[model samples]
Target: MPALFPLLRGRVLCSGALGGRKPDARVYARALAQLGARAAHTLFVDDLFVNVRGARAAGLEADTVRDARGLRRVLKRYGLA
Candidate 1:
């Protein structure tokens, strides 16, 4: 993953949590806030409702999708098409 983000110019690791952990929204939200982005200005997309709910709890707009078709529908509904 570090190789994928070699620039590492605007990245920060706030918590000691692993990326593979479930309900990582809290960690992500904190990192975003630390980087100067309000939760309301962020969008979180996940395949699991648990993660989505966690993100929403952190004040971000969250969505869950079961598959690619569902993701397309969600993007279209939000005028992201």
Candidate 2:
């Protein structure tokens, strides 16, 4: 992520660091708690469909992205680009 989006450096969360992996709702919950973010206001983007589904199940807005270009498009949709 740092290589693709330098501005996100040190601002990204790692599931492993949160003591869980993608597709595990706990990871997303922990992340939201740490960020003090509301599930409805957050967008979770991942390359895998399962992970995206997991986020949605956790009450977060989610999308599946293939690469940096796709990520850019998704972020743009959310007005974050």
TM-score, one value per model? 0.61, 0.83
Q: What is the C-alpha lDDT of each candidate?
A: 0.67, 0.90
Which sections of candidate 2 miss by over 4 Å? Answer: 1-10
Which model scores highest in TM-score? 2
Residues 1-81, candidate 1: write the lDDT tens digits: 234256446653425543334466657656676677787876667788987888787787879988878866776777664
Clashes of each: 0, 0
Measured on C-alpha atoms, candidate 2 has an lDDT of 0.90
Worst 10 residues of 1 by lDDT: 12-21
Q: Write the per-residue lDDT of candidate 2 for residues 1-81, one digit (tens) a residue.
A: 355478655557999999999999999999999888899998998889999999999999999999988988998899887
Name the top lDDT candidate. 2
Compute the lDDT for candidate 1.
0.67
After TM-score superposition, what is the CA distance of residue 76 in candidate 1 from its true location, in Å? 1.8
